[model samples]
Target: MSRFIAFFALVGLIGFALPRSAASQDWQLTDANTFAPANYLILTIPQDEPQALAALADTLAADFGVSLAAEWSLNALEVHCFVFDARNVSDVDGLITAMETDARIRTVQRLRSFSLTEMFHSDPLLPLQWALQSMRVLPIHASSLGEGVRVGIVDSAIDNHHPDLADQMVDLFDFVAADPVPLAEAHGTAVAGIIGAAATNEGIVGVAPSADMVGLRACWQQDGAPGVCNSFSLARAINFAILNDIDVLNLSIGGPEDPLLTELINVALEAGIVVVAASGEGQELVYPASLDGVIAAGQVAGRSVPAPMVDVLTTAPGSAHRYVSGSSIATAHVSGVVALMLSQDPTLTSAAISERLNGSISDVETLPMLNACTAILGPSEACAL
Candidate 1:
């Protein structure tokens, strides 16, 4: 592996080159922020390049006697939408029924919710994360630290003040509400640390420490420590990625099969963004991850340990770090590696990257663990296929 480092070094050193995006992406919720409103449904209308979006907004606002609190556009489908707040659940259902019969309307549905990729808070003292080492991340990092790549983490807000992670946060937003009521910062903080905690010789280094970090907070604490979000919130974050031309979008959260969320992911993929998702434990896959054309990630079933035990160590919230385990953690590993690859070649399409990853690694429990070095050098020369 060190030889691989020498090879990458001669070719420009394996120190990843990604850096956080500009502050222009940094935005907080304002009164105009349309998501997270109560007793509301999203209404869609077909308009190819909506020449008169305000006119349509006025029509909906005037006819329904409601405010046009927020709006979004599905460029892939050539339609725009408005979020409308109804008085009660009955009114929401009745409005949906009435809208379904309207010839001018395209799509309408009640808002949905999604939960954080469940993670556990463990003791600070833990083993080194082998997931990164196993992927030959050192060689890749020596060549690039995922510089110039923009990764949108759609979870709870990250620790904006962590010494190791503060500089990497180029932008942040709360999609669920004006501001997410942080329940446990460790989960999102840990994920951000895994993806790109700055290499400041601090508690722990991140996978792509220099890569640009964009906190797209779509989940908020509802009843437990883990954050939860619905379809509407998820859609808001995905649309942000598409509109802003984000390089990679990380969906560490999962829930049931949602049509709106599915369509939004499709839009992101079509716009040349690489989406990495986490699969739930066990053979059964979860939504978003189960969606085809996505790079689904999970832990490798190690030969020395029982498959039931998860022992991955990564970044946590606050000043102290912790050990957390789940497919969510594993997905972060892949995401970090993707950033490195993108840093080297921004034009590399998602399909080509997926082909190299899926085709290069030899089968390990029918789901091969990725090797970052091999992905860049081509499996035929650097890895076992």
Candidate 2:
């Protein structure tokens, strides 16, 4: 029940204090304008002396008008500098040259800022028909549709006005605004489409075509961002879903573990609702997905590769088809599959549903490439454990 503003304020107050191990390297800003709109510059410095690195960082920060954002100790040395102005780009180059000349700096690279769109469009899903036929998975034909289940989509608010989803949207709740629409990132719309978009020929079909949708805008809008949600608002949205008795909850956003959110998820599970969460893109597992009782889904590229420990493919708005991979998209697929299972039997408890899912997996033997359909449909008796 903690409020959003208070939580964010608390995180802000912590300021930028790099962990002890990361404080070893001195990262100097060379040129700021090299990156437009300000991007992170990564520097790898020698790690022979820790105190020297910290002192160097302090001196560089004073010499150049840049701030030390973060640092990590890895194979060599890692430092991130936040550039405030474009004019510093030239300064950054000069700084790099000076460091390289001094023999301390090993390498410097600009951290590329990637868009969700670029990530998704780079790889697309195999045609649904091909996936079903080749994988020998259950066909998501009109016959296996999720007719009576309700899925609560917690993310940016949906357009509801979009042509494909306009009529399928059932209810709306905006946890971010004084009103019911979200203005952050179109994240909700994209997630919602992945879960239950109607079967319109203009775009790709959702995993659960017949399921009803409940759009909850729990993320606060960032300035100038059109469709993104924040963590605090997300916690509120989860509570709202439980109170409203949503059958399935699809959470695509995650962050560090929040004790408050964890408690809420336990309560919802006890109430018999199935929660599906994304495991995040990197090696680290994000919360809600990592928590007990939540199905942590990882992304897969196509039918060919093993389920990606980090990516998934689904529908995006317009006529575009993108890989849309993330723990978020993977969570939606799990939610859709859960809806399909629920449609098979509405009375199944959350625990029972989870058991069936874990017990029936086809690729559980393979560590990470486990497919859900194989999990739910169970392999032949010869493959049974």
Candidate 3:
């Protein structure tokens, strides 16, 4: 298994060079601040003569008073993407309005960012989690500890060295800063703890304790603030997950409708990778979750698991353990259960898995929650209710 530190060093040493734009500016391959607001715009220009493209960049820079931050060509798509940073943040709308009229530009829009769905909470540990018992996790684990299953966490940076997560992590990719071991944050670390934390005697056991985890950091977090992720970083991470053949992808975040991200997730689903996401707060579902083929998890005391598992322990940054709440954590629990199902029967399709999970819910009022043991073994073979 490759550690995040090794990947970070390798990224630094073997950095790939980007083509300079016609404006005579070197392309900015990675953003210095991933979570910052939309001071930048993504412009799609038709592929043309190098001089023509350069002249266009120069003209745009001069007219709009913007600077080219990054530029890349998609030869197959016959287009070039140019990222420009506006000198005046407030001028973004004006610039977009003016650029939309230019005949040469294919598409232009201000970059959009997404966010984690979890709410942070810290408290003293309670020995047993109600969720674990409710789901009959132990009985399912008797057959499979999610061995050989890979769960991709597409969220904020995770604590790579946390005692509960250190050994469960199989890989790490930081689209946020491109660091090998992305900066750890509260949300991702907690979500990861819910899904794949190690079953060490000292800490809380995770839903799929032995499953493999790949922390793809598309989001960043600041102290005492919610984690944030933009479309470009998230698209890159999801593309990576698809290319790498991840078994199950957990998206413990929510955002508005986005065409680019929707398509990437669609491709992943079509490729037979199970994609799970938090259903946004309220009655309506968010993008990706609202899109077809995704298991939308909600926190209604329920396609979801129990919320406020007061005893549901999760890992936090700085190697600390704490309790967390929200639809994001519920999504993680579902992802973990999926991992367990996949481990036992790698051939199960996403639909079949969903049916088994929903069908196995033990009657607990109108609120439906997962029953892992019954989902894995037939209800007849499952542990007695």
Candidate 4:
């Protein structure tokens, strides 16, 4: 019976989030100048000959007038080459035909733009949506959403026009360009909205609706391909957050562990700032989530076997109210809950807060999930899980 009910509930949630027509929106061409600056041209070459393929790649880069960024050997039969600034293909269709005709080339794919905002709007467990509903039923009410907290989001840039988050954005910094204005990336804006959207009538409110937000653009915006800023950019962002005396630093991005980043995380910890990071997809742990003093979070559905470990919901971008599931989204949940805890006691140190959160988690025997509020507030001695 539980299985039967769970199946239907999953279907119902999907239906609620996405209507038939809404799913068929046409893919639009990416504007290189708007948000992304360069398009990536990915070419797969025959892998049997490394030296020959490298020579071919150099020839192709010179012939196509594009910069060759990285090349990797994928087994003995394939080599992948990444080309940057490839927006101006003389003839895209012709180029594909030529590549298909080339004996050395195996496949060619163009990187396209993906709407991060639209992706979030389709989430089923929107964080802010859950928080508002929970506020009505829970005994604790946040005196004010983010009454005295400052959150720094190191991602893309926030949309200054987002109705719920616009006013709360206090500053912008572009680590890539060393400028005050952020490079336009919808990913950052969506993240910002999740962290601190206002309780305005236009859309769903953030968990910390009144919190001040600092937008730090640490990720690069490529024209046709997804761009990533390196570990240095991330390390710098963490330092900036610490220097500014930010109460919390939210980092939703992740990659392979770097020693430099590990060192910087330690510095942030010593400075008494709460650092929250998304645990990677599935159970795979990622930094800074895996780092000590950082809250690592996972996602859960409303009907999942166990209550979510930091399974706080949030509003999706744009007008549609969808719920998203990700460690990044979970980071927002922890950040909002931390804001509530700080509101109750401003003197709580970062280490103290981390200890309280880890100790307060409600143990679910069914699954590895922890209740966000219970975790933040600590377990009640009289209550049984």
Per-residue CA lDDT of model 4 for 1-385, tens digit only, reads: 1111111111010111112323332212233334232256567654434445557777887776765654444333434443434656677666666667777666776644331111122223333465433322122233346678888888866666656666878987777775465245655665676667765445655667677789877877566244476887887887798899788888877788889988888888888788888776665567667776677765433211122324344433343344455666666666766776777788888777766665554445444444444544444321224
TM-score of each: 0.61, 0.56, 0.64, 0.56
Candidate 4, residue 373: Cα displacement in angstroms equals 3.5
What is the lDDT, from 0 to 100, of the residue 241 in candidate 4?
89
Q: Could you give me the TM-score of model 2 versus the true structure?
A: 0.56
* lDDT at residue 14 of model 1 (Cα atoms): 18
Residue-level lDDT tens digits of model 3 in 96-162: 9988998878999875543221111111231355676667676676578899999999998889889
- lDDT tens string, model 1, 1-385? 1111111212111112211221122111124333453466667786533336567767766766666655655445656666676653456666678778877678887554322221111212212655555565654555678889999998876887776677889988888776455434666787888888776544465668779989998877544467677888889999999999699898888789999889989989999999988876766667788887777777433311111115666666566676788877777777887888899888899888887666545544464566676787664233333
Taken over the whole model, the C-alpha lDDT of each candidate is 0.67, 0.59, 0.75, 0.59
Question: What ranges in model 4 sit over 4 Å off?
Answer: 1-128, 131-139, 142-144, 178-184, 221-227, 299-323, 363-370, 375-385
Query: Which should have the higher lDDT, number 1 or number 3?
Result: 3
Per-residue lDDT of candidate 2, residues 1-385 (tens digit)? 2111111112121134343555544433344224542244555655535666667666655655555655544432234323223244556566655545655456755544322111111112334423222222333332456789989988876767664566667888888777543332456777777677666444555667778899888764355364455567877898999999799998877777888888988998998899888777766567767787777766422211123323344444443444545566566667877887788678988778777655544444454343444445455421233
Local lDDT at 84 for model 4: 38
